[model samples]
Target: MASLGQMAAQSDMVQGLNAGLRRVPPWVLYLAGAGWAGWLFYLAATGGLGVEPIEALEHRYGELALQLIVVGLAVTPLRRHLGVNLMPFRRAIGVLTFFFVLAHFLVWAILDVQTLSAVWADILERPYVTIGMGGFLLLLPLAVTSNNWSVRKLGGAAWRRVHKLVYPAAVLGAVHYVWLAKGFQIEPLVYLGLILVLLALRSRPKATRLAR
Candidate 1:
C-alpha cells in the first residue's frame, strides 16, 4: 500500500540523516551556532534589525538560549527513544546555551538598563527580571563545570549532581518568558508546553527505574 511505501521511505531518510550526523565533526556544530550568533550581532550593529534593534537583539539572544537549552535537554531522550545519538554534541550545546543567556542578560543590562542603580532596581522590582536572574544563577555553576578539567576535579557523581540544576533552570527560564510577555501570548505558551513535555519524557524513565 501507499502508506507502507511512505513509511519505508521515511525510515530510509531518517537512517541517512542519522549516519550523516554521526560522521560530522562535533566542533562544526559549535562553530555554526556561534557563527550564526555573530551574524545576528553584526546585523544589529549595522542597523539591519529594523525599528527597535536593541529589543530585537535581546529577543534573538533570549530565544536562542531557551531553544538551545531545550535541545540540550532533549539529547538523551532523542538518543534513547528515537535512536538519534547526540551525546557527542551535548556539551557544546550546553556551553553555547549559557553564552547565549549571558548575551541576553548583557544586552538588557547595558543597552536596556544603562545604569547600575536601575539594573539593581529592576532586578528587585520586576518579577520577570528576578526570575530571569535566578535562572541565570542556576546556569552559572553548570557552565563553570562544563570543562573536562572541572569534571575530573569534581568527580562524576558530584559533577552530575551539580549539572542537574539544568532542570530547574529550564523551568524558570520558560516561566520568565511567560511572565515577560505583556498579555497571554501563544509563543510563550508553546515554549512552556514544549519544555514541560520534554521534562515529562525525561522523568518517566527515571520513575520506572526507581520502581524496580
Candidate 2:
C-alpha cells in the first residue's frame, strides 16, 4: 500500500494532468468568476438586469451552483475509483457553490422584487421560490462552518453530518429548477437525473466505505 505522502503526490500528479488538459490556471477560474460578477453589475447599471435579466441570471446562477455541487460530490468518487485525490478542490468548489447560490438569491431579492416584503411574500407563497430558499438556507450552515476552526470545533463526525445537508439541498435545488420552469423541460430533467445518479453512486457501500 502507498504511504499517505505517496498517495498525495500521485493525486497531485493527477490534478496537474487534469489542469493541463484544460490549460487554465486556478487563478484564471477566479478571474472568470470575477468577470461574471462584473458583467452582472454592468448589466444592472445599464438597466438590463431586470425581470428578463433576473430570469436569465437566476437560471445561470442556480445551474452553476448545481454544477459545483456535482463537482464536489465527484471528488470522492474520483479518488476512490481512480486513486486520484481531489479532496483539496472539494472545499473550493463547495464554497463557490455557496457563493453562486447566494448570487441566485440576491438577484431574486434585489433585482426581481426590489422590496423585502414582496420578496418575503413570494418566498412564502411561491412554491418554486420557497424550495429555492430552503436550499439556500441549507447551504448557509455548510458555508459558515467550512473553515478549519469550525471543522475542529465540530469534530469530524459532527462536521460530516452537517455537511450531509448538501444531499437534501441538491434535491431541493433540482425541484426549484423544475418548478421555476413552470413546465417540463429536458435540460433540467437531465440535471435532476444526473444528480440522482451521482447521489446514488456516492451512497453505495463501496463509495461510502472508501470515503471513510
Predicted structure with the largest TM-score when compared to the true one? 1
RMSD values, in order shown: 2.2, 5.8
Q: How many residue pairs clash in each candidate?
A: 0, 0
Mind sharing the TM-score for model 2? 0.79
Top-lDDT candidate index = 1
lDDT by residue (71-146, candidate 2, tens digit) is: 8877787777775555655767788889889988888798779999999999999988899899999999999998
Residue 8 local lDDT, model 2: 89
Q: What tens-digit string does per-residue lDDT give for candidate 1 at 60-93?
A: 9999999998899899888778777788898999
After superposing candidate 1 on the true structure, give the runs of residues whose Cα lies further than 4 Å from its correct spot. 1-15
Q: Candidate 2 at residue 117, lDDT? A: 99
